[model samples]
Target chain A: MQSKSNNSLIKVRQLTKRFDKLIAVNDISFEVFKGELFGFLGPNGAGKTTTINMLTGLARPDSGSIEISGLDCSKNPKLAQHLIGIVPDESNLYPELTGYDNLCFCASLYGMRKHEREERARDLLEKFGLSDAANRKFAGYSKGMKRKLTIAAGIIHRPEILFLDEPTTGIDVASARQIRQLIANLHDSGTTIFLTTHYIEEAERLCQRIGFIVQGKIVRIDTVISLLQPIQKKHTMVISVLHPDEGLHHKLISEFPEYSIELVSKGQFRIVSEKVINIGPLVRCIEETGGEVSEARRIRPSLEEVFVNITGIELNAMKKEKQKNGRSS
Target chain B: MKRWIAFWNILLKDMRAYYLKPPNISWGLIFPVAWTGMFFIKSGKGLDSIISLLPGVVAISILFGTTSMLAVTVTFEKKNKSFDRLLLAPIPLRLLMLAKTSGAILFGSINAFIPIIIASFLADISHVNWFALVLAAIMIAIASTFLGLFIAVSVSEVFEAQTFSNFFRFPMIFLCGLFFPITSLPIFLRPLSYVLPLTYGVDILRGAIDKGNIMPLWLDFLIILGFCVLLFAISLKNIHKRWIM
Candidate 1:
């Protein structure tokens, strides 16, 4: 039998890390295939950044191993780093340096010759749409401009694997759209991307495989279709009603014990169940409670719903925590 | 060849960011020259007194200028998060530190050079052994640069790094026999002077320029070289252990 890691470009086994007494990453194991865009979705303080740090050689794992392109990362991270590019969440490029200079400087750190570094720097500036601002100091760039410059800097060396942490957590809609398109373009060119994001829709759109991490451990990993498939039985029904009474939710729950009913508003209700719920019966129950059903339809399961199901925590709760942590830390 | 290229890239970037600025370039020259002028006025046209002060003045310039520049570089990067890029690079950490040290040496040596030239024309320290002076100046530059690296890696913030730089540098000026001869120091204080790198540095500089022998010239040279190696190793170890992650 062949080993499971045979075709994987990155293989991690029982990886763990600690800061003082706190265990930041705990025995996590996963594999990322070559040229695959894998999304590591998690809330704040869920060990996502810590795991990335260990994998990128910014920090060492206290236990286990990581292999990248058949290179043992734990033993020879310098060699491993040569094959990877990392875009940390913050724009950490030199503020005093011009956009062109930052890209050139990053290329030079990878030991690129002067002529090639400048050439590539100019190319990246044009590609990222920063050519007009190429000579302006990075300190003067807007947040979106800084983000583009940072991503350009990371890829200056043209590594095979790229790691991006929260590439678009907070930015204007247009700029965010631009960044997503750029990421997709990079992936199309055969670069394996490992991205972490709080935006479930972003992950569902970009990732070929998605991993849900919670409390420092990966709860589940699967393709987008596979993740949604297992939760198909958990269906939701949004019904438009007339004169919806407050007691209608209690009546529906009492009559249909297996179903969960919630009044979204006076004239709207959301009904959920683990099995295919019969809206025919729900309509009768609504009428008995003196409400007229206007519209009823099943709502498809979103990645957010799947994430909420897998992590056993509300998605909004995680977003609030992410914002708080972003502020304090 | 690749490592050298990487090193030069880092060196070039740092020079453009910190050492290449006009204010900084002038600061290195003005500081030592100003101190030398003060000593010249106090000595009242006695060429020997001013000349003796020249060696100590030049040595102190290299010490303060190099150490402060490096400390500022490291702490500023830490504050602004650019240090993360350096730590994440594929090159060995030692090479990065070496590149930073080399830049500091170049800046510091130029700082020492200005005073030597000014003193050569403005004040006469007769019978100067040009060879000994050149060698000693080079050694002082190397040693002071490494000392800068040592202080830089010990702190995490800009204000703290500068505070610590002064905390250590202020004492060295008086205790390293820069302003006073080592023999003039109390017997108990002589041991303290011997422990400081600047003591041997000043000994070499003063020995060469004054044409007076405190110890053998080669002994001073050996000691200065040893300090360079020791301080360089410590700085490299500190940066690797703390900053790499």
Candidate 2:
């Protein structure tokens, strides 16, 4: 990734958007510096998409100001549109056009010359692993191919900043991983990105700084390392055992008083502690109690824990939404 | 320079995605000829009356072609959110909208000629003012396309667009003197014909084809031009209010 700079490529302040009685984005403010991958981390309806819409001129804000590369876009939101690219939550390219045509059309909208757009489109198709499908109509592309082409179209003009609204929400794991890698490559090449996603792991893996927003309000904004600082000292482990019962649970709780132990399910238990857990004594105690430890694994503290702690929303809720979005898309 | 490039690209995209499709192309061709045939049979007028029927047939063809295309292109794209991509383009909203409507305008203008071409072979249209006819066809296309745009902007669904479009289109077909002269209408309904832009567009077409204009040629052209601007302005305002917000 490119080294972070102090130059702010996007600055939004006191931004508020209301739809009838509901305030979709309420008084949110943040800055994304040049070449930084800034994640607007939020669950469903947390104003992440709404904020991106306002910034990209897709929607107007009821109040507040937005400045892109020092150009005031408070009233005329399209002033900085030339300097930015947006990949909407859904693939918005023409379904009838071929992937190559879609990219060339988008580049043309950015005023790229014919030869330049065709070359760029070809390069993007190859880079996105879509050369094989270049001539196929977009309607025939799989979900993953559609998304990759959408990203390629977003960057066809090499805009200074890119706004990605849930770029990999519903794709398969392999495709999602490939997209993340591509996004990292884009960041490495020095394109500032404003990414929004409900996946805490995605934010943890990619973003330099993260902002946690919930219910149309920003709860916290900090560097990923700083955000993880509070949970860094804690350790969590999940152990699966055969013939687990309440007796073993109570005994383990009493034996490991310093650790928080809970029976997660029929054959599993979880143990969490602030200090590094010593497995020898805990395993020996369980074995002595005639319980067989089948599998024991350590869980890493990640942005999931930080998000839960800061926003007080259950991770299961996010997972349910992920599944919902996955099915719908 | 960049704005014009974007505008041209957007227009080309719409042509490729919507206008030039085989279904729409065949529909455009068949609909105009079908409408012309239906009017000819209904009027019980032989090929001898083809010149008098040309103006009304051309006007109706452009009206339906433009309205139906915009109904599909604008409302469907808005529903699927592809129009949002165009909205994000660096071009001004006015230019963006103009780019979007251009394909429909071109389509409608071409549709206007189908009947003219058919009529030219059957009737001696040698005395017709070809320049005035072409200009009238283009102006009629603009007015009707903007009317389609206004309908598309006011509604959210494609079905709603069709219904809303019919609310204006069906009335203009009779009230605009497309089939009959506005002077022959009841005085009470005469004002309604004047209020519809298609009336002036048909008048210009009638003047060019049959020397049957009630209003002066310049006045008819000016009124159609005014209506185009008015409809376009209203559509743009509605787009910002309903779609952007």
Candidate 3:
């Protein structure tokens, strides 16, 4: 792809990483614009973490280049890391140290002055709703508090770019909401955010451009609106039936060659069509097939459907059950 | 200058988290003093005899206590995965190693001094050479702690690091002329005694207290200093290979 704009804060090309015999990230290329919340959407083993590790200085890339703010970070990580902040999936912090001290120590790693770090740490503690627990040891805090403190530590130095891996993977709903709010506030304050997650709704709600990575390859990269635009004309109407025949899915598929019909459960079926789907054929086909439709309504196409359509796999199978929050977490 | 500030911060954090703990301090002090005290009782005590035991006991304190402390601290971080935070920082890996080694050395010196201060008034100091004694103590601390650091970074688990440290440390105590004169060792073991870094360190301390030159202070200092450099270099190389690359 050619340069779409000159204001790209991060440009990656031909990036690849291999662990023994498996290539974790393979020849993937993308650019994150300034102040853009770019989401790398993929399943568990899709190499999202591997790509982030290479972008930061934690691991070396086997081939290709990563230019962050015009510097070759893969080759010169020390200089690049100075301008990037990392919040790894795990909240890796000193458990023995208090929350306040942990923040101070992280700041000190970047060579911040004592007074400056103290002020920043206090402000972050208050902002993250951790002031009451600031004096508590990190190990003693709940999972939510630990996650909040880890994020606070990441932004202590105010780096130009922030890399968050699975930011809200496992946490309570309230904490996840607060973390998302913090992330939004950071984006609003003009800090570029690059995050990876398996949550389709998270990518849809937060990211301006979402990249779908499957098995170490990027399948597509575009705005959420554009990705969903192709499915706009397709109707995914859900119908309620008093009787559902087991053979109805195949019979409908054979009759309407251009539409996908699926039995969502025993009493419900969904029909996806390329054009306006008339209920006359479906109702008549169900009646002839020993099924009765009690009601029907058009359901909006969710990002989950878009993802499943693009990847040919259900979104629930890719993520853990506990990682699923209703809408945004 | 900023690099140095970061170095100091690393040292300060490790010192607070690991070195300042009561269990860690006591572990470095208890055994060395107990063994020496037992020996003093068996030898039918005299001020001179008690003073002679000080150098060997202090050397043992550094060998066992400092090495174990450094190993345990590092392995704890590795096992718990907290060390990842340090790895992501922008500072060079070598500087972090320097800060950790320096903190371990400082704690080792303090641990060694506990017995010496108590023995100071009990022993006859008019015949002692304080300058050479202090120099030998500092050298022993550096060599032992850096060697400890090498073990810490080379192994994947805490038990493995401790086992590797003791695999080398236990032999040195027996062969390093700490318990007896080097001439008294069997001919085969005599060469082994000279090869151990603790041998020169113990000899220097003994020579200082006795107001006698064992092998010329300069030669012994150079040997211990050489051991320090070799151990520190190996540690840095291992840490980079294990964590950085």
Candidate 4:
């Protein structure tokens, strides 16, 4: 969606981070152009946080080079720190400080003047819908409020580039939606954003270009449109049957040789094909095979399926992480 | 100029978040007074001995106050990952560390005066060298705060940092001639006393308050300054090797 401006703001070459015997980020190279919302998508332990830490100057890399806005930050990581903002996975702002104070403190770290920082902090608190809670201690705020304030603190200085690591991993749905909207507004305002998330749908909804990282390696990097192009040509449908016999799936597969069939459960199965399958024939075939079809619906292909196909990671694993994070929230 | 701004902000933030709290301020004031009273009664030293007890009390106050505050604050921030936010700042690492430890230094320097204030009420401190006392208190605070920083970065947990700090602190109290002369110690243990930063600090305080000088005032100040620089350098190196990596 025209995410690139042909002006690269971040460049990395053969970046690698090793912890003892484990290589967290291995030889990954990609450029994020100015004003682009680039997503780094991966499952848990896929080195998403590690990569963001290296880019944000939180952790030193074992090997490789990084350039932010044409400043070589390999040896001197703090050289480009003034131009970028970072929101870590967890809310790292001081719990003892009020929301307003946290923002002002972060602005001060970037060397903003006292009056300017105070005004900016107030503006951000209002914009983030946290004006009422601005005076409250951060530790007293809700999980969602804390996340919002952390994001506000990250942008307190109006940095040119922002790094958000799992911004909405363990937040309420409403907060997640609001955060996504805020990120979209930031991208629209021409701020280059490097967002790392495990939510495939979140990436598809917000990012222009997506980088799929698996086992510390970048498996694919392409625009959202380009990444979904191949999957879009295929039609998928999930059909639910009432008390289907064991042979029902075999019979359906034999009858529909052109479509790929997989038994999702005892009463559910999915059918995928290159061409759109006629619903009438599939229903008739199921009925003829002594299996009463309860529900059959065409499903749209999503980034989730593309991610699974590309990374060879089961969707169940990602879903488990989502559930775990949800329970914690 | 930008670096200085960041440095001041970091120091001010730490003050607001930790040092300026009413509870900590009270504790800082009360602890030194308690130590003074306890030691005075324990030694059965009358009013005449208050001046002699002043140097040890001041040194111990700075030592304990800086280490306790810094050990807890730094390790707690590291545990909660808040220190990572400071690490991402645009300031140099050395400057950032200085900003972080300066709060504890200021707290300790103020703490050193608590015993002096208490003694001034009971004994005549008019003869005391005020300049030397102030210099000794500040250098001791700096050296002790850096030692605390070193302990904090060397460990991952708050409790571990405290335990690590005590390994350096408890020995200094006895071996550094806090209440007694280093010559009274066995010859083998005398070398260990000089190795402790507080030994030089207490020696300076002794020269200032009691006119008891074992070494020249310049040598005492020089050695204490060297310890400050050395401790600060080592702490910064530990932060790079253990923390940033």
Evaluate all candidate structures by whole-model CA lDDT and list the values in order: 0.85, 0.90, 0.84, 0.90
Q: Compared with the true structure, what per-residue lDDT tens digits does model 1 show for residues A152-196?
A: 998999999999998986666778789999999999999999999
For model 3, how does the per-residue alpha-carbon lDDT over A1-329 read when each residue is reduced to its tens digit? 34556789899999998888999999999999999999999887899998998898767888989999988787877767778899988888899999999999999989899999999999999999999999999999988899899999999999999999988877877888888899989999999999898878778888889999988989889888898898877788988887778787788888888777777778787888888878998889888989899999998876777788888876457544434433334
TM-score of each: 0.92, 0.95, 0.92, 0.97
Pitting candidate 1 against candidate 3, the one with the higher lDDT is 1
Using DockQ as the measure, what is the rank order of every candidate, best first?
2, 4, 1, 3
Error of 4 at A149 (Å): 0.6
Candidate 1 wrongly placed segments (more than 4 Å): A1-4, A238-248, A255-258, A262-269, A274-298, A322-329, B45-48
Clash count in backbone of candidate 4: 0
DockQ score for model 4? 0.81
lDDT of 3 by residue, B1-245 (tens): 77787889989998989888887767766876797787788778566577778878878887776788888788788777678777778888778777767788888878777778778777866777879888888899888888888888888898898889889898888889787778888898889988888999998888887744468888999999998899888887777667654
**What stretches of model 2 exceed 4 Å from their correct place?**
A1-6, A247-251, A284-291, A327-329
Docking class of 3: medium
Output the number of the TM-score-best candidate.
4
Better of 3 and 4 by lDDT: 4
Point out the worst 10-residue segment of candidate 4 chain A by lDDT: A1-10
lDDT of 2 at A245: 58
Model 2: per-residue Cα lDDT at residue A150: 96
Q: Write the per-residue lDDT of candidate 4 for residues B126-172, one digit (tens) a residue.
A: 99999999999999999999999888888888889889989999999
lDDT of 4 by residue, A81-194 (tens): 999999889998899999998898889888898999999999999999999999999999988899999999999989999999999988898899899999999899989999
Best by DockQ: 2
